[model samples]
Target: MSTPELHWFKSSYSSSNEPGDCVEVAVASAAVHIRDSKTPHSARLAVAPSAWVNFLAVVGERR
Candidate 1:
């Protein structure tokens, strides 16, 4: 499938000087897009809105 059109945003914790380890995310329709910042053209994983919220909550608890 073709990649969806999206406006990507990097994590606030990402550093301007170091882009290698950063990830980019975008929201399209009811799905969320996730991809490596260094490879924008590469395949991205899409997650449902609810799943994305749960993932974030779990991640926040781990911090």
Candidate 2:
């Protein structure tokens, strides 16, 4: 399947001066897109909404 067009967004923790460490995300029709902000043109990972929520929950617990 072809990748869907996405409008990516970065977390508030992202910094313009340290773009390399930033993680960008986008919501598409069937999945969520995740890619490095420093290399947006590179390959991205897609995750289902349920998986994304679980991942975020884990991340939140670590924070």
Candidate 3:
């Protein structure tokens, strides 16, 4: 099996300036992928859609 290409987008909170630490995310049918915007080729983290939703909910409550 092969991995399909993902369309990643930068986090809205990331700095608008270039050469800064940033986070990127890509949503797939099975998982949400997260990675550093600067080192895109580096290892990434993937979580189930449900887990991602739960995470957002938890984080939202703290805001």
Which candidate gets the maximum lDDT versus the true structure? 3
Superposing every Cα of model 1 onto the true structure, what RMSD results? 2.9
Which 10 consecutive positions of candidate 3 have the poorest summed lDDT? 11-20
- Mind giving the per-residue lDDT tens digits that candidate 2 earns over 1-63? 876568989965466678578999998778988988879999989899899889888877877
RMSD of 2: 2.6
| Model 2: lDDT of residue 5 | 66
Clashing pairs in 1: none
Write the residue-wise lDDT of candidate 3 on 1-63 in tens digits. Answer: 999999999876566787568889899999999999879999999999999889888877876
Residue 44 displacement in candidate 1 (angstroms): 0.3
**Cα lDDT for residue 48, candidate 1:** 100
Expressed as tens digits, the lDDT of each residue in 1-63 for candidate 1 is 886679999965466788687888898887988988888899999899889889888877877
Pick the winner on lDDT between candidates 2 and 3. 3
For model 2, what is the error of residue 41's alpha carbon versus the real structure, in angstroms, after optimal superposition? 0.6
lDDT for 60 (candidate 3) = 72
Error of 1 at 3 (Å): 8.5
TM-score, one value per model: 0.78, 0.79, 0.78
lDDT of 3 at 61: 85
